[model samples]
Target: MGRARFAFGVLAFGYAFLYLPIAMVIVYSFNESRLVTVWSGFSFKWWQALFANEAMLQAAWLSLRIAFASATTAAVIGLAAGYALVRARRFPGRTLFGSLVVAPMVMPEVVMGISMLLLFVGSERLMGGPDRGFLTIAVAHITFSIAFVAIVVQARLTDFDRSLEEAAMDLGATPWVTFRTITLPLLLPAVGSGWLLAFTLSLDDLILTQFVAGAQSQTLPMRVYSSVRLGVDPQINVLATIVVSVAACALMLSGWLTRKKV
Candidate 1:
């Protein structure tokens, strides 16, 4: 009983450590004070300001579009990579290939951002196309996001029963049909989780976005960072509240989907 109580206490403390600041941010989102540290009275003025700020609104919308596109593109490519890693066991470069697939997950974001920046700069010099903007940021995000999705899918596939695929094939189904009808449904939970992770990563990213984002393509986080650098505006609190709400919804939806699929 004592040990159980101690464990529960630790768990509660851990959760408080993680969420207390977030709770404070949510509560202060309505504060009338311009300073985040001070709470004057509750007001919706900040929400109005957030809506009125055209630059911030545009940045937020652009960020969402980039995140959605990056997550989807990453999911597709990562799914194929993971499938190959699992199914093609006898390939010559199988070991190197597997290592490369997961390398980004462990790599530093700063390193990745710099590397992608250099790649984009070189590509521009060579092709004189796809300039530093939405396309570049989305591609950079997809590069890192792919590793995360590949890891998730690979884990799910590792323990999956091959008999299901084999059984479908024996019933005169083609490889594509078997994968679409039988294999994909079982892998939906992992894929959805990966997509959600990729989306969240793309949305919350700052350093990587900074390296690739052009002047006209600033994202919400970049906007917020610039604003906070000048001063903590009440509108930033409102923006944080909105972003947190959206992220929470995505997480809950992913959980529901996973449970339903399982």
Candidate 2:
């Protein structure tokens, strides 16, 4: 009983530690006061203000578009890479290929951002194309997010039953047909999860965005960070609340789908 009590207490404490700040932000988002610290009363003025802020709205929309593109690209690339890693018997430079794919996942954001910046600059200098903006940011996001999707898909594939594929093949299904009819369906949950995770990572990323984002390509995080430098406002809290709510919903949906798949 004592050990159980201790475990419960620790769990409760950890939950509070993580969520209390988020809860406070949600609560303050409704505050009537312009000042975030003091709650004047419950009001929708801040939400109204947030909606009225055209720059913020534009940045949010741009971020969403980039996230969607990045997630989709990452999912496709990661799925192919995961399949290659799991199914291929032998390939040239396999170790180097895997390491390169995973390098962005573990590399520090500052280093990754700098490296991406240099690569973009060099590419532009050589090709005289692919300027830094929305497209570049989305590509950079894909580069980092692919590793996450690959890891998730690889984990799912590692323990998967191979006999299922063998049986399909024995039944005269071609490799492409079997994969399309069986493997893809089974891996959909992991693919969806990877997309959600990549979207969230790209949405929350500020350091890399700052490095690659041009004057016209500000994302939500960049906008919010710039606003906060002037001082914290209730409008920023409102934005934060909206972001938290959306992320929570996505995560919950992903978890439900994964559970259903299992």
Per-candidate TM-score against the hidden true structure? 0.95, 0.97
- lDDT for every model? 0.89, 0.91
| Shift in Å, residue 182, candidate 1 | 1.1
> Can you give the lDDT of residue 256 in candidate 2?
89
User: What tens-digit string does per-residue lDDT give for candidate 1 at 85-184?
Assistant: 8888798988998888889888888998899899988988899978899999999899889998888888889988889899999999999999999999
- On TM-score, the candidate that comes out on top is 2
Each prediction's RMSD to truth? 1.5, 1.1
Residue 95 displacement in candidate 1 (angstroms): 1.7
Q: How accurate is candidate 1 locally (lDDT)?
A: 0.89
Residue 255 miss distance in model 2 (angstroms) = 0.9
Candidate 1 global TM-score:
0.95
- Where does candidate 1 clash, by residue pair? none
